[model samples]
Target: MQHLEDRFNKRFGYPWVFLNEEEFDESFKTAVKGQTSAPVSFGLIPRDHWFQPEWIDEERATQGRMEMKAANIIYADNVPYRNMCRFNSGFFFKHPLLQPYRYYWRVEPDIQYFCDVTDDPFDYLRDNKKTYGFTISFYEWEKTIPTLWATVKEFMNLHPEYIAAENAMNYLSDNGGETYNLCHFWSNFEIADMDFWRGEAYTKFFEFLDSKGGFYYERWGDAPVHSIAAALFIPKDELHFFRDIGYRHEPFQHCPRGEDWMRGRCSCNSYDTLDYAPQSCISRYEKMFH
Candidate 1:
């Protein structure tokens, strides 16, 4: 919290909304509130939105977990993690406390912001008519989403009218929607318009995916879900890559090069920037506009 306050929130004074499955203790609230003068809100995830739907087959889900565990998949044995993924994928935007806000900047703990933000990203998104903006892109774990692409293809075939004519399909699919090439924008560092997710197109898309039971039967992540929606429902130009904001999350870091680094007081080495790493899809994302 202190790191974030010192980096950007202190200057912007934007309110912080924190959501958890359980009530936050007083100490947690005090620590967060003390970091910045910005209003801090703690929201509890509604029971219905954070639990497995009644229609899901518990036995099948158990078997799926066992299979994934045997295969050494990450978080395969964690039920709450799966629930968190499902909630973020389909229900987070619908929370009552978030309804009044038109734009949201998703931030996670332990992530670093190397740059001092000079302008409000929300203004950039609104003035430029952008629906989705992100700092990093990567290929999804194929093992984790074996059936997701097939499900998406079915949705596209059933609702062709919902797709944009100038979508970023090339960035997602190589065989013309026959299969998912696994590329997706990492959702952890997103600043997006909530109206896009609240719209009929995205709502119906989420409903369709939810009905298929992938959230429990398979591990469907919010990153891939949001990425597919942005790539298909929004125009190519409306999706932005926030290259100026130097950011890092765990294994990867995006350090701005040259002037951006010097002006931002960034301490990271430009050569270590993962923007051009083989595992990243940033180069492909750049080709879409460049």
Candidate 2:
């Protein structure tokens, strides 16, 4: 991450970083790390465990929570980490310090990039009311996500108080509790409005989900967790498409300039980019050879 930041700064000039202690590794701190680049500061959210360890979740949740609580100490002391994880990384606060910054671009280390970004994405968000933005999209992991749906349903059931809320409850539910079509997003790289996150709806939503303990048991990835929550909590119109920055999404490739992003790419041929439109889901899902 440090090497990437150094190179990123040299290229982009003090890019903003939402980072954590884990990124504080020797390689990371060496370059124009956090403070080196003015507003390019790091959020430094606390991370309990990397979620890479021994023992099944059922046996280790208690230990995990303890570690997470210890990490939260930094926030309690008024210190904050730019990087945040939903589970043990307890930095899901009310967006206190983020007000000054008009935009937030999520940063994760070690990902592939194929094309250069010609347009300025941050300016796009700042100029327009694009409260939510992402590059890739996919369905939920049914096994791991069943609990998430259940948790969301239970939250709505118990808080019938928020049934009338304008932001979240609506987007998360169209056919009652059957689906979450609006929950699709590529959170590995999210650049959004901080004001939208600091709202009461999102604030309480995170807290409600946080209390559920699934972040420990089900092993929720912050990317998907945040995606679902943001989908539920943020308005759809504020969402946007950056059809130019090239990004690698695990098994898929994203290219804004590729003829695909210009229209839609779902070709099995990895040689060509995949499609973003759902109409291509059929032929594209048939084979994985590409």
Candidate 3:
């Protein structure tokens, strides 16, 4: 919270809304409050929104978990992780406290900020008509989402009308829409228009995916879910990449290059950015424009 405040929110004064499955402790709330003068609010996630639905077949979901765990997939055995992915995918934007807002910047804990955020990305989204913005893009672990692409293909077949006339399909697939290339924008950090999620296309998309029970039966992540929807439902140009924000979340980081590093007073190595890494989808995303 402090790092975000010093690097960005301090200048923009954007209020922060923190949500959790359980109530936040007083000490933690006090600590976050002390981080910035910006208004802060905490909300407890509804029980139904943060837990697996009763309709899910526990036997099948358990078998799925066992298989992934045996294959050594990260978080394969963690039910809480599935709940998180599901909540983030379909319910976060629907939280009562968030309904009044039109735009949001999702921030995770322990993220390192290496540069000063000079502009309000919320304004950027609104002014420029961009629906989603992200700092990192990469391929997901194929082992965790074996059925996801097939399911997505099914959804597209059934709801072709929802797809945009000009979309970012090329960024997601190498051979038309036959297969998913597994590339997705990392969702841990994102600046976006919540209305897009709340809109008809995405709401229906999430409902279709949720009905499949993939959140529990398979480790379908929010990153891919959001990326796939944005890539298919909107114009390709509506998705913006925030190259100026130097940010890191654990094993990967995106440090701005050349003049952007000097402009932002960034500390991370410019050459180390994942923009062109073999596993990154940034080059694929860039290709859509040229």
lDDT of 2 by residue, 1-290 (tens): 44333323345654454544444556555563443454454454334422322334545555544544565522221111212345222343333345466676665666665543434667787778667777666554444444777777777666655433334433344565575543446677777776666666556766777666555544455655666556555554566655455566556655555464444332223344554455222122222112
The residue-by-residue lDDT of candidate 3 on 147-224, one tens digit each, is 999999999999999999889999999999899999999999989999999999999999999999999999999999
What are the Cα lDDT values of the candidates? 0.89, 0.51, 0.94
TM-score of each: 0.98, 0.65, 0.99
Report the poorest 10 consecutive residues by lDDT, candidate 2.
Answer: 74-83
TM-score preference between candidates 1 and 2, better one: 1
Which should have the higher TM-score, number 1 or number 3? 3
Ordered list by TM-score, greatest first = 3, 1, 2
Q: Predicted candidate 3: what Cα RMSD to the true structure?
A: 0.7
> If both were scored by lDDT, which would come out higher, candidate 1 or candidate 2?
1
Report the lDDT tens digits of candidate 1 across residue range 108-171.
9989888877778899999999999998899998877889999999999999999999999989
What candidate 3 gets wrong by more than 4 Å, as runs, is: none
Query: Quick one: best lDDT, which candidate?
Result: 3
Candidate with the greatest TM-score versus the true structure: 3
